[model samples]
Target chain A: MNLKAIWWKLFCVLLLIYVAIAGLLSPVPRLNILNETIRNLYFHVPMWFGQIIIFTVSLVYSILYLLDTNQKNASSIANSKRDIAAHSAVTIGMLYGTLGLLTGMIWGNFTWGTPWSSDPKLNCTAIGMLIYLAYFVLRSSFTDIDKRARFAAIYNVFCYVMFVVLIFVIPRMREFSIHPGNGGNPGFATYDLDSAMRLVFYPAVIGWSLLAVWIWTILVKYREIKLFWNMRMNNPLSAVALDQV
Target chain B: MQAIITLIKKEATIEWRNRSVLGSLLLYTVLTVFLIFFSFRNLDPLSWATLFWIVMIFSSVDAIAKSFMQESQERWFYYYTLFTPGQLILAKLAYNLVLMVLVSTFTLLLFSLFVGFPIHDIGFFALALLGGVVCLTVLFTFMSVIAAKAGKNTALVTILSLPIAIPLLAVIINFTKKTLVVQNAVIYSTDIVLLCSINLLMIIMGYILFQFTWKE
Candidate 1:
């Protein structure tokens, strides 16, 4: 790949390496309770940021797929491409969300004295994850590629709207949350002590988000290549046109 | 408007002709409430509220699971020619709302008779129940359409809708619990606002998206 095409990928790698080194060895506030564990902010919180970015990408592609289908000049191949892109983004978003949950559990174990609690944030996250899991189940039940892609895109849009509502409503309804900045607890932002943490924290979020998008693009390309190869194996002549795509 | 009303009436006539489905659902509610009654002769308000919502969720799922699959393909084609997808979905949603309202009323009556009636604020209870019913019916109606298209049974419908319904369920359950167990706790308008907005969102989404699912 040329430098222009791979510049963001290079940026993601370099930034992540810096984060890994500085996140651990960099000077942090010496607090009474969260002396060392505060470094989790660098790793754990960025997963959610990355997940949200990828999930938004998935939602946009799903919407595009629907809008494209409604057009009179819609092509089958382009429609399928949008569907594949949306699915790949969701699959990667799920990975980021799972990592966030795992990292959160470990942090909660040390600080909250339990891996899981009745905290609204925790429950809402779990429910959001389940919604996407059901999306996969819904997709797998279909055998026809066109039907699966169309219905999955429709379901994707539906669930994303509901999930956004859930995230918006749940935290406001409850008066208490063990998570920071909700209810009465101090937010992680306050613990920055100085501008030192924000320097690492903001880059960590951006780097992880870019890394997620990069993986999603790779997955989309892989699927397209596989589709092309299968087409070539079936009919040698038809394969020439798909090469342009 | 007229088409939606006619479609709703058609649905009611079909449901009326097949009374066994409604009967079985009522029986299921009774059996569930009785099982809970026998297991715990006396219960506190918290358990009462918890078990009540549990029954509400399951029974609603059972009742609305058949909304789309009960019709034949030929009948759907016939209806498709006569009415637009928006009209068809609106009618189904309205009919399911009525059916769920009846089922929930019966369930609530059974709970009051079997377990002690813990809810003192009838107005608040009714408001919460209405929100819950609207949320469940709109959501399940759309989901049953998807499940039927997949050519699967009620299990697929349950798996698909239940997870997405959790947040609405959580809000309703929390509101009901407040009405039942807490004293001097005012009814929170924000909760009602949240429920109303969620219901509106789902109904609008279902109306717009049903056309995509209805396509053959």
Candidate 2:
């Protein structure tokens, strides 16, 4: 493997290992209620940062897919890959998002005394999950590859815009939520960071986001190979000729 | 502009020709509201706002989902040669807006008639309704096109539109709830601006994105 190509992967691995060890053992502010669970900031918060990073990457790929379609000399293979990238990114992003939700729920149970509350951020995450689930369903309903790719890209773009608006709009509607950084409560940045947590928090965010992209690359490659295998199976002669080559 | 108007006129004439379709939509609204009236008998202002928006969302989906589906492919092919996709979508959006206005007004009247209108500031409520209708119409109209293109899976329309419509519906519901009483009336200008900006964004997005969907 190329040293240059694998630097970030190595960084991601090192940072995450450091986080796992240092997160549990590190001293945190002995605040009431939060107490030891304040350490969740290292894990739970990074899931959202990772999810948003990957989702933004996915949205960009979707836009590129749409834009590439307009050019007369555009390569269909590249366009298809863009669609696949967008799809895979969404899959991984959703995985991170679900993890974020579950982690938040577990933390909320211990802290807020319930598995879930009607917090704006929580509701937004739930709705955001639904929108992406619909994207997958919409993709599945179409039979033609090109048509499915195009339509899914369109929905991906539209859904991203709305998801972002929901993220901003919902919290503003209700002035108070139990979540940090919203309504009266000071965000983690102000009250909780305290330099030591920031050491782990920033690295954890970067590490998790890099890990998401790494997983996304693996997913894209798997899907691409699956597509290639399907194409070959449909044409045994092509498979035989390619095997000879 | 003239082309858009003509296309909207064409939509109106088609809806007028199938009068039963419009009547059935109204009947759907009335029956749903009647069901709620029977079940609840009395609703608090919050529930009233919520239920009203729920009915509006579903009925709007039912009404607008067919906007693209009702037209035959041959007619679309013909229009494809005549008008741009942007013109066609804008026209459909305008027509759906008008249709939703009628449906929402009818639903509001039925709610008042059955459960007693609780809205104190009627004029402000109208503004919120218009805002909700415009956003819902814009988003659903585009989603319907995507649904129609993807083999006209009409159920896909609701699944696709409802989640995206959450923000708009949330703001409108909150805004309308405030209008239910004269004393708690704090009509935040930010919400109104949010709705307007969202409407503008949806319109621009629909116009741009429909071209890709229209191409194939």
Candidate 3:
């Protein structure tokens, strides 16, 4: 196999092993300290952290796209770069968001007495996900390629802003929260997250983020290949130009 | 000044001309108020206040989501406007805020009449209504831009809007309870401050972000 394929396989194996070890072994004697429920933090906190990192990357690309559109560049190079960034961010953001929701649901099932409740934090996350889902639907509604990209970038930026307000600001203001730390629940403020918890939590976040970037790179390559094929099929002469790159 | 007023007037006129939009908004508002009254025919004042704000929140979503959809349908005209996005948003917010206040007033009046609850602090109730209307208008304006771009109808808008609206809804309900039932200001000072802060934050954030999403 090619060197690139070998590297990707190795990376996947390493990631799987790391996640398993961290998830299964790290919460050991601490289980006696905080109970079996503390185990959920291994998955839940990292998913939320990964989501924020991906969304921050998405916003940067969106701002870059707006700036690029106003500047002069080789049309193909500019479009390709912007498309890669935009598509990668969306894919990774969706993954992080999905995992975050799942992990939170799992954590909730044990901690909050039900898998899901209308807690303010939980509700805000649901809304944030819907906003992003609408971003995808908005892209699909437009037939023209350029219009779709432009509109999607604009909507993506809006979603990011709304995400900040809904998730960060709104929940803190309310007096009725089932989530820890707000509204009368004795939260993280009281219980010190031990050094042991931090060890696994930090690495889990880094590992998940790196995994996101690794997957994003593969997806970008796939997109480039697909675009190249489309260009070739549409005009055989253009195929030579792409192949040279 | 004149140009802004003209834009506001033009938007208001267009909104009025869309008879179906206004008609539905009015009908929905009236129906929701009546439903709340019917559902809690014998509930206490606190329950009545809670049900009233819940209905208002949903009604606000219904009316505001359509605010931009009508303009989006005629893309060419919307894009050809001389005003910047900030101006357009301002106009939309002003128009919607007026409509929302009127709707809230009508709903509350009908609610008071049918439910036969004693309103303890008239001034606090008015303040609560004003705060609720401001919060709803700013939040809905932002959501309208999102819904306009999303192009999914009512369900999508609700999913997008309901969460953002919660803090405001909570404050409104709490304020109403304090005003219409408890008749105490000292109990809800913090809630009032939080509601005002949310309104301020939403307006500033919505203004800053409007141009990004308003692009044609």
Candidate 4:
């Protein structure tokens, strides 16, 4: 690997180490009863944070793709960059979404007295996850590359808006939840989270984000290779076509 | 203005020509309303109103998806209408709004006849219905466009529409509760304003984004 790749790997390693040490050893003294259970927050919240970051990256790439398509002198480099960014975002977003659901389920089991509830927040999140899952389903259903990408990009934009409404707006509007500041249930403020918790939480967010980016980079490279193979398969006479051009 | 009028007229004409589609939508709406009224026979006025909103929203989805999905099957006509995606969206929104209003009113009327609940404030109820219809139409119009290109149009439309529809659902239910249970006009006035804001936002966003979505 190149120097930049090596540096990223080192950065990720250090982040993982920091999260491991901080999450285990840190004394969240403010959370008197919950104790070690509060540590799950470090992992759970970061997964959502990382998912939002990846989704934002995906949206940026989609806007770029739309603009690039309209341009007469679009650079291959720009197209490649947009492709890499988009593929990376989707891959990372999927991972974060899966991890978030898993961690949230565990957290829910302990805090809410059940693994799942009909709370609006939980329902909306389940719906959001299913929507993204449908996004991949829509992508796989199409055999045409150009059509798949275009359709997926449009769907991504639509889902992102829904994500905003469901995750952010809807939960805040209704007062029916065990989550923080929703209904009668006590939340983070009730816990009086210690400074020590903050120490782990911030780093966990950073670590998860870095790991997502690292995984995204690898996935983008893999996608590029797959696309390359597909193109070569489709255009057996590409060499002749290139010679004529 | 003329373009918009023509587009609206064209959409109405197209919809009229497809009598089966319109027939199915109307039949579905009527059946849903009847089922809800039958199932919730013992429900209080508040619960009845809640069920009514649910039926209306789902039925609106059935009607609006038809209009949006027709664009994909008639690609040439859709492209020809591209001289005005905003006007086309508005026209679609207007048509769907009218359809939703008719369906909601008919369902509510049948609900009153069957369930025998007194509507305390007819004026507030009318305002709530207007707000709810506008919200549903604007929201579903955008959803219809998104679902138009989806692999399974029916499933995708439902998935994509539900999340956005929740806010509208929440507002409508709250308004229904206020009107039917508490008989409070003041509570629903705020909700009606919020619903109107949502309608305005959906329209502006739809106007801006429909171009991106509608491009061939």
* Fnat of each candidate: 0.62, 0.76, 0.24, 0.24
What TM value does model 1 have?
0.94
Error of 4 at A105 (Å): 2.0
Where does candidate 1 stray beyond 4 Å?
Answer: A1-4, A73-75, A171-174, A232-240, B181-186
Q: In terms of docking quality, how is candidate 3 classified?
A: acceptable
For model 1, which pairs clash? none
Give, for candidate 2 chain B, the lowest lDDT window spanning 10 residues: B182-191
Worst lDDT run of 10 residues, candidate 1 chain A, spans: A166-175
- In model 3, what is the error at residue B144, expressed in angstroms? 3.2
Q: Which of candidates 1 and 2 reaches a greater TM-score?
A: 1
Candidate 1's C-alpha lDDT?
0.85
* Residue-level lDDT tens digits of model 1 in A117-163: 98888877888888889889988999887788888888899999888
What's each prediction's TM-score?
0.94, 0.94, 0.80, 0.87
List the candidate 4 regions with Cα displacement exceeding 4 Å.
Answer: A1-5, A30-33, A72-84, A141-143, A165-167, A170-176, A180-194, A239-245, B72-78, B181-185
- Flag regions of model 2 displaced more than 4 Å: A1-4, A73-75, A170-174, A189-194, A236-245, B183-188
Kindly report which residue pairs in candidate 3 clash with one another.
none
TM-score of chain A of 1: 0.93
Judge candidate 4 against the unseen true structure and give its global Cα lDDT, from 0 to 1.
Answer: 0.71
Query: Model 3, B1-216: lDDT tens per residue?
Result: 555688778777887687787788778877877776677677687878888888788888887877777665566265556777777788788888888988888777777787775668887778888988898888777767766666645666676566556655766786787776554468767667767887887788778767655544
Q: Which one is best on lDDT?
A: 2
- Model 4 lDDT, residue A28, Cα: 71
DockQ of each: 0.67, 0.73, 0.28, 0.39
Q: lDDT for every model? A: 0.85, 0.86, 0.71, 0.71
lDDT of 2 at B175: 81
How do the residues A5-56 of candidate 3 rate in per-residue lDDT, one tens digit apiece? Answer: 5675566557656766876776544333346777677677777777778778
